[model samples]
Target chain A: MRPFSFTKIDNAANALAAKKEKSQFIAGGTNLVDLMKKNIAQPEQVLDVTTALSSEIEDFTKGIRIGAMARNSALTTNAIVLEKYPLVSKAVLAGASPQIRNMASTAGNLLQRTRCPYFYDVTTACNKRKPNSGCSALEGENRMSAVIGYSEQCVAVHPSDLCVALAALDAKVNIENSKNKKSVISFGDFHRLPGNEPNRDNNLPENALITSVEIPSNGFQKHSAYLKIRDRDSYAFALVSVAAALELQGTRIVAARLASGGVAHKPWRWYDAEAFLKGKEATAANFSEAANIAVQDLKPLAHNGFKKEMLQGAIATALQQCLTV
Target chain B: MSKESTYSRRAFLKASGAFVMLASIPYSLKAMYVDVDKLTVVPKQALSITVSINKKSYSVPADTRTTLLDLLREELHLTGAKKGCDHGQCGACTVHVDGERVLSCLTLSAMIQGKEVTTIEGLADGEKLHPMQQAFIECDGFQCGYCTPGQIMSAVACVKEGHTGSVAEIKEFMSGNLCRCGAYNGIVQSIQKVANA
Candidate 1:
């Protein structure tokens, strides 16, 4: 790794001041440190934000507020988060391993980079890493690349299961800037698709930092879960995962919030599937119908053609699990 | 059991303590300490750290780039935390900080200036072993024992976090700590032993 200066800051102003000098903000450093070692992320200075920001868990009038620095392990085990939002808990649990969840924060989990090997390998021409360099995953091993919400410039899958759950549940992020000013952005727009620019991820300014995530007040009473299908049992990223939350009014479906990961550049909201599930009886046929709507207009690469079917199966399984409520 | 393997309890305790010291401490500090002739410790520049470990206080100066794992093993002589993968991909350097389990390898020593940390070495009493430690031993949860500390730390947190509802739940929750020796069945059984208890 290249030699660099490290500074610890305890406030937003200090972190932004360091950022002005081109220092990268380090929260959990789960992703930043790995990239730094690989020489992919070479910042001249590192600003440790773990000391600056304070994470909290509180009840919001609208819902719950999860501090950005709160670890995934803490969130998964918190009584409120577990009881009120099983979807979030399950999503958190389905993520990386125990130690990772312990060190990984909610904000960091949301900002974790794609799992595309091309992006990690400095030798590969990945547009996500270097714009206009072109995505090698398009022609190379693309099994885990995006099958939906993809652009020609990049097809990398968003590797975070928590983001998919948050997007499906309509969570919102609260961000603070250098001036200590705050604003809220929907989780749907929190992560952007690979447009002309793949490097430009969330609509976050250079000096802006995430503070907390607020999942909207909803009745997720029982029907919700995050189903991640992977090659191995542990320490593996998802091949295809579905985050679904269903609302039941007797036997008919009152509402549905569905989002997919490991198959999209961003957390993908299946609006068509959600729209099709309204007022329909929760059944095998309805789930299959919703699955068809979810995969509409999907364009899979040669190696990831299996993902399309895998994604469909995952969605079916997740929706069926939701029906049990 | 083999006759040669029947070691006495006193011999077992002495051997375990030595193993703990070797596993946790850096090679530089492995030398015996002299009583009267005190060794003058040259403090590193521009560093003043006070971090709590296993509910005890410690004050040590560390390099800016030093990771918590390195600081524990090299500087403070608390070496139970293993450095399996320095890249945070492996959980061999797992420990508890402020009642939360964390990866010491990914964490910089400077970042945890005022937090409580707990390593496997601190988990046992003067003569009594922590329940999780005892369970791991009884269940044969480790082979080479490199990843045992991390596995045990994660297991303690797993039970405290209520991830012990079912076998699948425990497996899913504890999946982060990898065992390259393929002692997962024993590892899970060890955690289950404590969780059930």
Candidate 2:
């Protein structure tokens, strides 16, 4: 890590005002510090914004507004989250370990960089790490890389389990901008698809700080499941994860929200599949067909061709799990 | 935990928060800090901070890049927290910051000002061992013992966090600390013993 000046952020407005060129905000430091250790991120100035942000999880009649600085641990155990948004709660618990979940903030989790081994190794040529240097994962170890929404520049997938659930639930991100004005961006628009600019992860505005995430009321509360398929049962990144939420009447599906992680650059949602499942019988055959539609356009790499089948089975199983609940 | 019960000159000097006082301190006092200067002139970044470790206050001049794990093991001479992996992938450097278990390897030393840090060395009451520590010995919860400190610290917090309702629950909650020697059976037994008691 290079020598850098540190500034203690006093508030959201001052934190934005204090931003200079090559200045990165440090909240949990779970990912940023690791990047710094590997020299992947060398910010000239480090801003500590943990105290400047609120950590409240406000639950209202409309829905839940989770403060950006709220720790992942709090989301797992909070009564409101567990009762009303179990899909989100389960996704948070399924991601990192208890210690990491305790320290990592919600906003930091949303802004997590890909866990591509090539990106971590500074010696390797990674386009995401260095612009136009090269994409190591394109021909390297890409079993965990994206199968869709990837370009020649980068194939790394977004690595947030909470994001998968939030994407499915139609969440909105409230941004505290540099002008001290508030703007809300939809979850889908918040993250980029790694097209021409793989180096840029999200669509965050200039000097923008995420204040909270607003999740509106949805009727999938009773039937929602977050299924993560990983090598280990716990404390491991997902091979493929499915967040299935269904608004069902008896054995008939009224509405559905299906999205997946580890399959694309962003949380890959199957709006077509969701539309196909509407008003249909909530059976294995329908769910299987929906899963097939979800994977129709997936372009898997050599090492991860089996991920298509794995994801197909996972999506079907996750939808079935939601029904059983 | 008390911010008032500190008389250590190192702690007091940092608490004073004046560069002139640091310059006036004796030669012996000058030797106690890590780097007591500026960042622009020198090629190093250092900050004077006051932190509490094992219920003792410390006023030290720390490098801005020093992690809490390095600060504990190198500067403060608290070797209970081991660094199996400096990255957050492994939990060998687990410690309680403000009573919540967090990975010390990722926590910056400058971020810990005015916060209570409890390492494995602070778990016992004087000569008497903590209940979890005593249980680990009875159940033979470790072989190499490299990850024992982290495991015990996480286990203690697991029980306090009400995550010990079952053996499966205990295993899930203690999944952060990895014992490469496959001592999970005994580690789980030790947690069970302490939780049940």
Candidate 3:
């Protein structure tokens, strides 16, 4: 890895000052260090913000507010988060192991790069890394690539479980700039599709830093959970995962929110499924209908024909659990 | 001597003995307490700080680039905290800073000034083994043991953090500390023994 000067800041203001000079902010450093070793990311200076940012958990009458700097392990283990937001806790727990989670932050999890093989291997042409260079994953080994919201330019799935849960929860990100100005954006808008510029994944400016993630209190979260299917039980990325929250009035669905991972450029929120499940009788048949709507438009690659069925199964299983609970 | 003086001396000796016994309790139930605010690393700018580790105080000069793992292994000859996948992917370099488990590899030594740092070497009495350490031995929680120090440190924190409720929870919480040998069954069992005890 290329050596860089490390500066420890005491507050957000100092961090912004360093960002103004184009220094890279290091949070968990789980992803940053790996990319640096690959020469994919080489910053002249690294701003270490682990100590400066406080890891506090605040409780409101309605919901909990998690500081962006709070470690993933802390967020998952917090009593309130575990009781009220099991989906969020499950998502956090299902991710990388305790050591990485101890260092990885809640905000940093959403900012992790895609696990597309081409994106990591510098020899391959990845549009996400070098814009318009051509995507090698398009015609290469793409068993783990996307089957939804994928353009011909890129097929990388967003490799994060927390983002999928956040998408379904309608969480918001609070971002601060060098001038100390703060702005908020819903989690859905935080990550973007490849579109024409696959390089830009988030809406934040180069100098903006994530401050916290705000999850509003929603009534339907009582039966929510994050279920991931991976090749192995521990320490492996998802083959397909589902985040589902449903509210029911006896047999009929009152409200629902759904999102999927390991299958899209962003956390693929199933708006069509949401609309279909609304006011419909909540049953296995209805869940199948909603699942069909969720993956009807998927365009699978040669080696991943099973992803379409896998995504449908994930949606079905997630909905079944929500309904049963 | 007065009867009261003899009685007080006997009581004092008994209390001291109990205190020693309390400190020597099975490592699993032992509380590894550390203070975070008072921690600071050695200085590069001519500001010297002394750090106490395993009952010994070391006054050393260090650069900003130095990490706690590096300072212990390279400068102090405490090579127990192995540097595996230095970017924090592997927990080979986990240590207790202020009683909280942290990746020493990712933590800069300068950040730990005046703080008590505990490694695997600090987890035991002179001859008696820590319960978790002994459990690892009996259960064979490791093979090659390159990641043993880190695994033990995380296991200590895992019990402290109250994540020993069930096997699934233990597996999830301990997932951060990877044992490449796939000795997860034994590792989990060792932690369960410590937690159950």
Candidate 4:
């Protein structure tokens, strides 16, 4: 890793000031440090934002607010999160191992880069690493690449399990810019599709800092599950994961939210499938139809063709788990 | 001034001169100046940080690129924590910071300044081993013992967090720490022993 300067900031203002000087924010250092060692990320300066930001998980008027610096492990057992947004807790636990969950912050997890092996190898030409450099995974080993929202330039997938649940919960991201001005971005608009600018992972500005994520109160708490299908039983990235939350009235679904991971650049939400499930009976046939609709428009790559079927199975399994609970 | 002080000043000047000359050369040849003390050719600047480790405080100058794993083993000579994978994939570099288990290899030394870090070395009371350590030995929870320190550290946290409800739960929580020797059965037994007690 190349040598760099480290600045520890104690407030948001200082953090924003440090960012204006071509510095990357460091929180938890789980993903950023790994990328730095691989020579994929060589920031001239790293601004320590762990101390600068708030780490509280508090209740808002109609929802809960999770501080950007809150550790992933803390959220798994958080009283408010586990009670109100159980899917969020399930997704957090399903993701990384215990050690990584302890170190990785909530905001850092959202800003995590792709785990593409080719992107980590500096010798390889990756468009995400170098614009227009050509993506090696396009014709190389791409079993983990995105099956949707992919372009000729890049086929990488965003690797955040928590974000998938956030997408299903209709969470909002609170961001502060370098000018000290704040804005709220809906969760769906947070991550970007890997079009021409796969290098640009999200829609946040260069000097913006994520403050917290807000999840509005919902009735999906009693019937929600995060199902992650990986090659191994645990401590692995999802091959095809589903975050399903259902609001039921007797045997009928009053409302539903579903999002997918490992099949798209961003958390792929099937609004059509969600709409179709509303008012439908909570049965395996209905769930299977909705699952089929979720993957209807997918265009899988050569190695990841299996994901087309895997996504359907995962969605169905997640919905079944939600209903049984 | 003493004679020793004067000699040290001259040595510092010589090293600075050599650094200036070597900085202009290509990075590939910068290794030639590795023998120079007090002044080494680094691509980026160094920062001085004070870190608390195992109830002791250390003030040292570290390269911004240095990780907590490297600082503990290479600088402080605390080789108990192993680095199975420098990346966070493997859990061999697990340690507790502020009472939470985290990956030391991914943690920058600068990030843990003024924070309490408890490694495997700090788990016991002098000659007395921690309960988790005793359980591991009694249950034969390891074979090659490469990942024992990390496993023991994580097992302690798992029992504290109340995740050891059953053997399956123990296996899920301890999945982060990988033992290539397939000592998972014994590892689960050790965690169960601690949790049950």
Q: By DockQ, who's the top model here? A: 4
Candidate 2's TM-score: 0.91
Sorted by DockQ (best first), the order is 4, 2, 1, 3
Residue pairs that clash (backbone atoms under 3 angstroms), model 1: A10-A52, A97-B176, A98-B176, B24-B79
Model 4 ranges off by over 4 Å: B1-43
Contacts from the true interface found in each model, as a fraction, amount to 0.56, 0.69, 0.33, 0.87
Cand 4, B chain, TM: 0.78
User: For model 1, what is the error of residue B24's alpha carbon versus the real structure, in angstroms, after optimal superposition?
Assistant: 60
Interface RMSD of each: 5.6, 2.2, 6.1, 1.9
Summarize candidate 2's per-residue lDDT along A136-206 as a digit string, tens digits: 89988999999988999999999899999999999999998888999999999999988889999999886
Q: What lDDT is reached at residue A100 by model 1?
A: 75
Clash pairs detected, candidate 3:
A97-B176, A98-B176, A99-B176, B39-B113, B39-B115, B40-B112, B40-B113, B40-B114, B41-B112, B41-B113
Sorted on TM-score, best first, the list reads 2, 4, 1, 3
**Per-candidate TM-score against the hidden true structure:** 0.85, 0.91, 0.84, 0.91
Indicate the docking level reached by candidate 4: acceptable
- TM-score for candidate 3, please give it: 0.84
lDDT of 2 by residue, B8-101 (tens): 7787777777867766898876565434432233267789979999999999888888999999999999999999999998799999999999
Which DockQ values do the candidates obtain, in the order shown? Answer: 0.23, 0.38, 0.14, 0.48
Estimate the TM-score for candidate 1.
0.85
